[model samples]
Target: MRIAFPSTEKLGLDSPVYAHFGSAPYFVIVDADGGDVETVENKDLHHLHGNCQPLRALGGISVDAVVVGGIGRGALTKLNQEGIVAYRAVEGSVSENLALIKNDGLPRFNIDQTCQGHGRNGECIH
Candidate 1:
């Protein structure tokens, strides 16, 4: 399965996961079966609060799922419509999250769980 993780830097699997999907600058795409990895820049990083475009941020590369610290309802809906599941990421690097995915440890983000606002430290205030 191909999994995408939103990251703040281009550290590959060691990259720290960004707090918000739409605002992340890079993405670490991991191929679980083949053990291949790819990093891509977010094409659509700047937008209004409710206008995040998941496909555009991913550079149109198809993936089975996305791992993020937070995501808005609109972006989550868009990803779901494209058959991509969004999982709530733990507070760690992409490598940690990848391991969690293998064990089905991450929780799928329901619409209500989506980010409604940002916290004082920039975490999801949902």
Candidate 2:
């Protein structure tokens, strides 16, 4: 499966996972079966409240799922509509989150569990 992780930097598998999906600077795409990895800049990183377009930010890169610390309800819904699943990520690097996924430790993201706001006040609900 092709998994995408919101990353703070382009450090490949060692990159720290960013807290907010919409504001993350980079996305680390990993091929689970092939062990291949690539980094892509979030083009639509900046946006007004309730206007996060994650798919556009992804630049059309095909991904089976996303592992993130937090995500907004709209973004989560959009991802679901597009057939991409989102999983709540643990507090760690991309590799650590991957381990959690392999162990079935991460929970599938739901609209009810999405972040309440844009995380501007440092209150991420995820």
Candidate 3:
């Protein structure tokens, strides 16, 4: 499966996962089966709070799923509608998360679990 991870840097699989998907500066996309990787700039990086255009931010890249530490209800809804599943990210780099993915360790974010906003520490406030 191909998974897109919101990253704070453009360090390929070694990039640390960003706290919020829409606010991430880069997206490191990895092809799980083949190990192909691509990093793209998040086009909508500066979007207003609660108004994340994920598709635009991802530069319209096609992928099976997205892994993020936090995401808003609207963004999650949009991704679900597009047949893209959003998995909650663990505290680690993209490479670490990939290993967990092999064992289905990450959890999916439901609407109620979505962030209403971000805290000062960049953590999602649900």
| lDDT per model vs. reference | 0.92, 0.89, 0.91
Count of clashes, each model: 0, 0, 0
Question: What's the ranking of the predictions by TM-score, best on top?
Answer: 3, 1, 2
TM-score of each: 0.95, 0.93, 0.96
- Better structure of 1 and 3 per lDDT: 1
Top-scoring candidate (lDDT):
1
Which residue pairs clash within candidate 2?
none
Per-residue lDDT of model 1, residues 4-80, tens digit only: 99998999999998889988989999998899999999989887778888899898899999999999999999999
Q: Residue 28 lDDT in model 3?
A: 97
Worst 10 residues of 3 by lDDT: 117-126
**Angstrom error at residue 84, model 3:** 0.3
> Model 2: per-residue lDDT, tens digit, 1-126?
999999879999999988788888899999988999999999888777578898998989999999999989988999999999999988889999998888889999988898887445544755
Give the distance in Å from residue 61's predicted Cα in candidate 1 to where it truly belongs.
0.5
Local lDDT at 92 for model 1 = 99
Q: In candidate 1, what residue range of length 10 has the lowest lDDT sum?
A: 117-126
Expressed as tens digits, the lDDT of each residue in 1-126 for candidate 3 is 889999989899999988889888999999999999999999999999888998999898988899999999989999999999999989899999999987999998888888898899777887
